[model samples]
Target: MGAAAAAAGADPPPSEAAATPAREDQQHYVAAATGGVSGESCDAAAPPAGGGGADDAVEPVVIDASAVAGGAGEEEQGECGFCLFMKGGGCKDEFVAWEKCVEEAEAAGPSVDVVELCQDATAALRKCMDAHAAYYEPILRAERAMAADLESFQTEEAASHSAASALASEEGQR
Candidate 1:
Protein backbone atom coordinates (compact mmCIF):
# COMPACT_ATOMS: atom_id res chain seq x y z
CA MET A 1 0.00 0.00 0.00
CA GLY A 2 2.85 2.37 0.86
CA ALA A 3 4.56 1.64 -2.42
CA ALA A 4 1.30 2.01 -4.33
CA ALA A 5 0.58 5.31 -2.62
CA ALA A 6 4.11 6.54 -3.36
CA ALA A 7 3.80 5.42 -6.98
CA ALA A 8 0.62 7.42 -7.21
CA GLY A 9 2.51 10.59 -6.19
CA ALA A 10 0.63 11.17 -3.00
CA ASP A 11 3.75 12.74 -1.51
CA PRO A 12 7.43 13.33 -2.26
CA PRO A 13 9.50 10.14 -2.40
CA PRO A 14 12.38 9.64 0.07
CA SER A 15 15.06 10.01 -2.63
CA GLU A 16 13.95 13.60 -3.18
CA ALA A 17 14.18 14.20 0.55
CA ALA A 18 17.79 12.95 0.71
CA ALA A 19 19.23 15.48 -1.77
CA THR A 20 22.03 17.61 -0.28
CA PRO A 21 21.33 21.12 0.95
CA ALA A 22 23.85 22.54 -1.53
CA ARG A 23 21.70 21.44 -4.46
CA GLU A 24 18.67 22.94 -2.78
CA ASP A 25 20.71 26.11 -2.31
CA GLN A 26 21.75 26.25 -5.96
CA GLN A 27 18.12 26.19 -7.10
CA HIS A 28 17.39 29.13 -4.87
CA TYR A 29 20.51 30.87 -6.13
CA VAL A 30 19.32 30.45 -9.70
CA ALA A 31 16.03 32.08 -8.81
CA ALA A 32 17.86 34.95 -7.12
CA ALA A 33 20.35 35.44 -9.93
CA THR A 34 17.62 35.97 -12.46
CA GLY A 35 16.94 39.74 -12.58
CA GLY A 36 13.19 39.34 -13.18
CA VAL A 37 12.40 37.91 -9.72
CA SER A 38 11.97 41.22 -7.84
CA GLY A 39 15.41 42.88 -7.92
CA GLU A 40 16.42 41.45 -4.48
CA SER A 41 19.74 39.67 -4.10
CA CYS A 42 20.33 36.53 -2.01
CA ASP A 43 22.99 38.31 0.04
CA ALA A 44 20.34 40.68 1.39
CA ALA A 45 18.27 37.69 2.46
CA ALA A 46 20.95 36.31 4.81
CA PRO A 47 20.44 36.52 8.57
CA PRO A 48 22.60 38.94 10.52
CA ALA A 49 24.66 38.17 13.66
CA GLY A 50 22.46 39.22 16.64
CA GLY A 51 21.28 42.49 15.09
CA GLY A 52 17.73 41.64 13.97
CA GLY A 53 19.42 38.70 12.27
CA ALA A 54 16.36 36.91 11.02
CA ASP A 55 13.89 39.75 10.54
CA ASP A 56 16.63 41.95 9.10
CA ALA A 57 17.69 39.14 6.79
CA VAL A 58 15.68 40.62 3.95
CA GLU A 59 16.03 43.86 2.14
CA PRO A 60 12.61 42.98 0.91
CA VAL A 61 11.03 43.97 -2.37
CA VAL A 62 7.66 42.39 -2.50
CA ILE A 63 6.67 40.59 -5.71
CA ASP A 64 3.05 40.39 -6.66
CA ALA A 65 2.49 36.62 -6.88
CA SER A 66 -1.21 37.09 -7.82
CA ALA A 67 -2.23 35.48 -4.52
CA VAL A 68 -1.81 38.74 -2.60
CA ALA A 69 -3.86 40.62 -5.16
CA GLY A 70 -6.39 37.77 -4.50
CA GLY A 71 -6.67 34.40 -6.22
CA ALA A 72 -8.94 31.33 -6.03
CA GLY A 73 -6.42 28.47 -6.42
CA GLU A 74 -4.21 29.37 -3.42
CA GLU A 75 -7.19 29.80 -1.10
CA GLU A 76 -8.03 26.12 -1.62
CA GLN A 77 -4.61 24.47 -0.92
CA GLY A 78 -4.89 25.16 2.88
CA GLU A 79 -2.34 25.45 5.73
CA CYS A 80 0.80 23.42 6.30
CA GLY A 81 0.29 20.61 8.86
CA PHE A 82 3.89 20.99 10.05
CA CYS A 83 3.67 24.72 10.69
CA LEU A 84 2.33 26.72 13.65
CA PHE A 85 1.10 29.15 11.00
CA MET A 86 -1.99 26.96 10.71
CA LYS A 87 -3.00 27.96 14.24
CA GLY A 88 -1.95 31.59 13.80
CA GLY A 89 -3.78 32.26 10.49
CA GLY A 90 -0.55 33.24 8.81
CA CYS A 91 0.61 32.80 5.21
CA LYS A 92 0.76 29.14 4.18
CA ASP A 93 1.86 30.14 0.69
CA GLU A 94 5.38 30.52 2.04
CA PHE A 95 5.61 26.81 2.73
CA VAL A 96 4.10 25.97 -0.63
CA ALA A 97 6.74 28.12 -2.32
CA TRP A 98 9.51 26.57 -0.21
CA GLU A 99 8.36 23.09 -1.19
CA LYS A 100 8.37 24.06 -4.84
CA CYS A 101 11.94 25.35 -4.54
CA VAL A 102 12.98 22.13 -2.83
CA GLU A 103 11.43 20.03 -5.57
CA GLU A 104 13.17 22.05 -8.25
CA ALA A 105 16.48 21.87 -6.42
CA GLU A 106 16.20 18.12 -6.06
CA ALA A 107 15.32 17.68 -9.73
CA ALA A 108 18.23 19.79 -10.91
CA GLY A 109 21.56 18.14 -11.79
CA PRO A 110 25.09 19.22 -10.82
CA SER A 111 24.49 22.96 -10.76
CA VAL A 112 27.66 24.65 -9.57
CA ASP A 113 27.40 28.27 -8.58
CA VAL A 114 29.27 31.43 -9.46
CA VAL A 115 28.34 34.93 -8.24
CA GLU A 116 26.38 35.22 -11.47
CA LEU A 117 23.75 32.49 -10.97
CA CYS A 118 20.15 33.28 -10.10
CA GLN A 119 19.38 33.49 -6.36
CA ASP A 120 15.75 34.61 -6.37
CA ALA A 121 14.29 31.16 -5.77
CA THR A 122 16.58 30.55 -2.84
CA ALA A 123 15.86 34.03 -1.47
CA ALA A 124 12.17 33.49 -1.91
CA LEU A 125 12.34 30.19 -0.03
CA ARG A 126 14.31 31.86 2.75
CA LYS A 127 11.78 34.66 2.96
CA CYS A 128 8.94 32.17 3.09
CA MET A 129 10.65 30.21 5.90
CA ASP A 130 11.36 33.38 7.83
CA ALA A 131 7.80 34.57 7.47
CA HIS A 132 6.59 31.44 9.24
CA ALA A 133 8.90 32.01 12.21
CA ALA A 134 6.03 31.22 14.58
CA TYR A 135 6.62 27.51 13.89
CA TYR A 136 10.12 27.70 15.37
CA GLU A 137 9.03 28.21 18.96
CA PRO A 138 6.50 25.38 19.01
CA ILE A 139 8.78 22.93 17.21
CA LEU A 140 11.68 23.75 19.52
CA ARG A 141 9.46 23.37 22.58
CA ALA A 142 8.16 20.00 21.44
CA GLU A 143 11.66 18.70 20.69
CA ARG A 144 12.86 19.65 24.20
CA ALA A 145 9.81 18.03 25.82
CA MET A 146 10.19 14.84 23.82
CA ALA A 147 13.89 14.62 24.63
CA ALA A 148 13.26 14.99 28.34
CA ASP A 149 10.44 12.45 28.30
CA LEU A 150 12.55 9.91 26.45
CA GLU A 151 15.39 10.32 28.95
CA SER A 152 13.07 9.83 31.94
CA PHE A 153 11.35 6.82 30.37
CA GLN A 154 14.63 5.11 29.54
CA THR A 155 16.03 5.62 33.05
CA GLU A 156 12.90 4.31 34.78
CA GLU A 157 12.62 1.31 32.46
CA ALA A 158 16.25 0.36 33.08
CA ALA A 159 15.79 0.58 36.86
CA SER A 160 12.66 -1.56 36.80
CA HIS A 161 14.32 -4.22 34.63
CA SER A 162 17.41 -4.30 36.91
CA ALA A 163 15.20 -4.65 40.04
CA ALA A 164 13.28 -7.52 38.48
CA SER A 165 16.51 -9.30 37.49
CA ALA A 166 17.89 -8.93 41.05
CA LEU A 167 14.66 -10.35 42.52
CA ALA A 168 14.78 -13.32 40.14
CA SER A 169 18.41 -14.00 41.02
CA GLU A 170 17.61 -14.01 44.79
CA GLU A 171 14.69 -16.39 44.22
CA GLY A 172 16.93 -18.74 42.21
CA GLN A 173 19.57 -18.64 45.02
CA ARG A 174 16.94 -20.07 47.43
Candidate 2:
Protein backbone atom coordinates (compact mmCIF):
# COMPACT_ATOMS: atom_id res chain seq x y z
CA MET A 1 0.00 0.00 0.00
CA GLY A 2 1.11 3.57 -0.65
CA ALA A 3 2.33 5.92 2.12
CA ALA A 4 -1.05 7.72 2.08
CA ALA A 5 -2.97 4.52 2.73
CA ALA A 6 -0.46 3.42 5.34
CA ALA A 7 -0.87 6.79 7.06
CA ALA A 8 -4.63 6.34 6.73
CA GLY A 9 -4.38 2.87 8.33
CA ALA A 10 -5.88 1.14 5.26
CA ASP A 11 -4.81 -0.28 1.91
CA PRO A 12 -5.57 1.62 -1.34
CA PRO A 13 -7.72 0.05 -4.10
CA PRO A 14 -5.74 -1.98 -6.68
CA SER A 15 -7.15 0.21 -9.48
CA GLU A 16 -5.38 3.25 -7.98
CA ALA A 17 -2.04 1.44 -7.55
CA ALA A 18 -0.62 2.54 -10.94
CA ALA A 19 -0.88 6.24 -10.08
CA THR A 20 2.43 8.05 -9.45
CA PRO A 21 3.17 9.63 -6.09
CA ALA A 22 1.94 13.21 -6.09
CA ARG A 23 4.48 16.02 -6.42
CA GLU A 24 5.18 18.05 -3.28
CA ASP A 25 2.75 20.72 -4.44
CA GLN A 26 0.09 18.18 -5.49
CA GLN A 27 0.20 15.98 -2.39
CA HIS A 28 -2.75 16.50 -0.05
CA TYR A 29 -2.64 15.86 3.69
CA VAL A 30 -4.72 16.53 6.76
CA ALA A 31 -3.53 19.81 8.23
CA ALA A 32 -4.33 18.77 11.81
CA ALA A 33 -2.53 15.39 11.86
CA THR A 34 0.00 14.77 14.63
CA GLY A 35 3.03 17.06 14.42
CA GLY A 36 0.98 18.85 11.71
CA VAL A 37 2.04 16.36 9.01
CA SER A 38 -0.38 13.84 7.37
CA GLY A 39 2.32 11.52 5.93
CA GLU A 40 3.04 8.23 7.68
CA SER A 41 6.19 8.01 9.75
CA CYS A 42 8.97 5.67 8.53
CA ASP A 43 7.95 2.89 10.94
CA ALA A 44 4.16 3.34 10.68
CA ALA A 45 3.34 1.17 7.64
CA ALA A 46 1.12 -1.97 7.78
CA PRO A 47 0.91 -3.81 11.11
CA PRO A 48 2.67 -7.16 11.59
CA ALA A 49 0.92 -10.17 9.96
CA GLY A 50 -0.96 -11.33 13.06
CA GLY A 51 -1.42 -7.93 14.71
CA GLY A 52 -4.95 -6.51 15.05
CA GLY A 53 -6.24 -3.80 12.77
CA ALA A 54 -5.37 -0.13 13.51
CA ASP A 55 -9.02 0.43 14.60
CA ASP A 56 -8.34 -1.93 17.52
CA ALA A 57 -5.74 0.45 18.95
CA VAL A 58 -6.81 2.60 21.87
CA GLU A 59 -6.05 6.30 21.87
CA PRO A 60 -3.92 7.48 24.75
CA VAL A 61 -5.69 9.55 27.39
CA VAL A 62 -4.31 13.07 27.68
CA ILE A 63 -5.02 15.34 30.65
CA ASP A 64 -5.75 18.92 29.70
CA ALA A 65 -4.40 21.84 31.77
CA SER A 66 -7.97 23.06 32.20
CA ALA A 67 -8.63 19.84 34.12
CA VAL A 68 -5.98 20.71 36.73
CA ALA A 69 -7.57 21.25 40.14
CA GLY A 70 -7.52 24.86 41.39
CA GLY A 71 -6.53 26.03 37.92
CA ALA A 72 -7.08 29.78 37.24
CA GLY A 73 -10.09 29.64 34.92
CA GLU A 74 -11.90 32.61 33.44
CA GLU A 75 -14.57 32.56 36.12
CA GLU A 76 -11.98 32.26 38.89
CA GLN A 77 -10.42 35.66 39.21
CA GLY A 78 -9.14 38.21 41.73
CA GLU A 79 -10.49 37.82 45.25
CA CYS A 80 -8.07 40.54 46.29
CA GLY A 81 -7.81 44.26 45.59
CA PHE A 82 -4.64 44.43 43.50
CA CYS A 83 -5.52 41.35 41.44
CA LEU A 84 -9.02 42.67 40.60
CA PHE A 85 -7.50 45.98 39.56
CA MET A 86 -5.21 44.29 37.06
CA LYS A 87 -7.59 41.63 35.80
CA GLY A 88 -10.88 43.54 35.48
CA GLY A 89 -9.23 46.47 33.71
CA GLY A 90 -10.56 50.06 33.74
CA CYS A 91 -12.58 52.19 31.33
CA LYS A 92 -10.90 53.82 28.33
CA ASP A 93 -10.53 57.23 29.99
CA GLU A 94 -9.06 55.71 33.15
CA PHE A 95 -6.79 53.44 31.14
CA VAL A 96 -5.56 56.37 29.03
CA ALA A 97 -4.72 58.39 32.12
CA TRP A 98 -2.87 55.53 33.80
CA GLU A 99 -1.06 54.70 30.54
CA LYS A 100 0.01 58.29 30.12
CA CYS A 101 1.37 58.46 33.65
CA VAL A 102 3.40 55.28 33.26
CA GLU A 103 4.68 56.19 29.81
CA GLU A 104 5.85 59.64 30.95
CA ALA A 105 7.59 58.14 33.98
CA GLU A 106 9.25 55.42 31.85
CA ALA A 107 10.44 58.01 29.31
CA ALA A 108 12.26 59.81 32.16
CA GLY A 109 14.38 56.70 32.84
CA PRO A 110 15.49 55.70 36.41
CA SER A 111 14.80 58.36 39.04
CA VAL A 112 13.16 58.95 42.42
CA ASP A 113 10.24 60.73 40.65
CA VAL A 114 9.53 57.70 38.45
CA VAL A 115 9.64 55.41 41.50
CA GLU A 116 7.16 57.69 43.30
CA LEU A 117 4.89 57.74 40.24
CA CYS A 118 4.85 53.93 40.11
CA GLN A 119 4.03 53.75 43.80
CA ASP A 120 1.14 56.16 43.35
CA ALA A 121 -0.23 54.20 40.38
CA THR A 122 -0.05 51.01 42.42
CA ALA A 123 -1.95 52.65 45.28
CA ALA A 124 -4.66 53.97 42.95
CA LEU A 125 -5.13 50.59 41.29
CA ARG A 126 -5.37 48.84 44.65
CA LYS A 127 -7.87 51.37 45.94
CA CYS A 128 -9.97 50.82 42.83
CA MET A 129 -10.12 47.07 43.59
CA ASP A 130 -10.85 47.63 47.32
CA ALA A 131 -13.85 49.72 46.31
CA HIS A 132 -15.43 46.75 44.53
CA ALA A 133 -15.13 44.49 47.62
CA ALA A 134 -17.33 46.83 49.71
CA TYR A 135 -19.76 44.02 50.74
CA TYR A 136 -16.89 41.71 51.88
CA GLU A 137 -16.94 37.98 52.93
CA PRO A 138 -20.58 36.92 52.51
CA ILE A 139 -20.61 37.96 48.83
CA LEU A 140 -17.19 36.43 48.26
CA ARG A 141 -18.31 33.10 49.77
CA ALA A 142 -21.41 32.92 47.54
CA GLU A 143 -19.27 33.58 44.48
CA ARG A 144 -16.78 30.92 45.54
CA ALA A 145 -19.59 28.40 46.09
CA MET A 146 -20.97 29.03 42.60
CA ALA A 147 -17.47 28.71 41.12
CA ALA A 148 -16.90 25.43 43.00
CA ASP A 149 -20.16 23.98 41.62
CA LEU A 150 -19.21 25.03 38.08
CA GLU A 151 -15.77 23.47 38.42
CA SER A 152 -17.34 20.28 39.71
CA PHE A 153 -19.69 20.08 36.72
CA GLN A 154 -16.85 20.73 34.25
CA THR A 155 -14.62 18.05 35.80
CA GLU A 156 -17.40 15.49 35.92
CA GLU A 157 -18.44 16.20 32.34
CA ALA A 158 -14.86 15.76 31.09
CA ALA A 159 -14.41 12.52 33.08
CA SER A 160 -17.65 11.09 31.65
CA HIS A 161 -16.56 11.89 28.09
CA SER A 162 -13.17 10.27 28.60
CA ALA A 163 -14.69 7.14 30.12
CA ALA A 164 -17.34 6.86 27.40
CA SER A 165 -14.67 7.01 24.66
CA ALA A 166 -13.80 3.35 25.44
CA LEU A 167 -17.22 2.26 24.12
CA ALA A 168 -18.59 2.80 20.65
CA SER A 169 -20.89 5.84 20.73
CA GLU A 170 -23.91 3.83 19.54
CA GLU A 171 -23.25 1.03 22.05
CA GLY A 172 -23.39 3.53 24.92
CA GLN A 173 -26.82 4.77 23.77
CA ARG A 174 -28.20 1.20 23.71
- Per-prediction TM-score: 0.32, 0.23
Model 1 lDDT tens row, 16-105: 222222433323323333223232121122221111123422222222223322456543222222321222223345445544444455
What is the TM-score of candidate 1? 0.32
Report the error of model 2 at residue 59, Å. Answer: 41
Reference-based lDDT, residue 8, model 2? 39
State in Å the error of residue 126, model 1: 14
**Per-residue C-alpha lDDT of model 2 across residues 1-174, encoded as one tens digit per residue:** 777546433222232222322322111221112122233221121111111122322222221223222344421221221122222223223333444566577668767375466555544543442343321222233345666888899999999998788576768789
Q: How far does residue 128 in candidate 1 sit from its true spot (Å)?
A: 12
Worst lDDT run of 10 residues, candidate 2, spans: 42-51
Index of the highest-TM-score prediction: 1
Model 2 segments beyond 4 Å from truth?
Answer: 1-95, 133-174
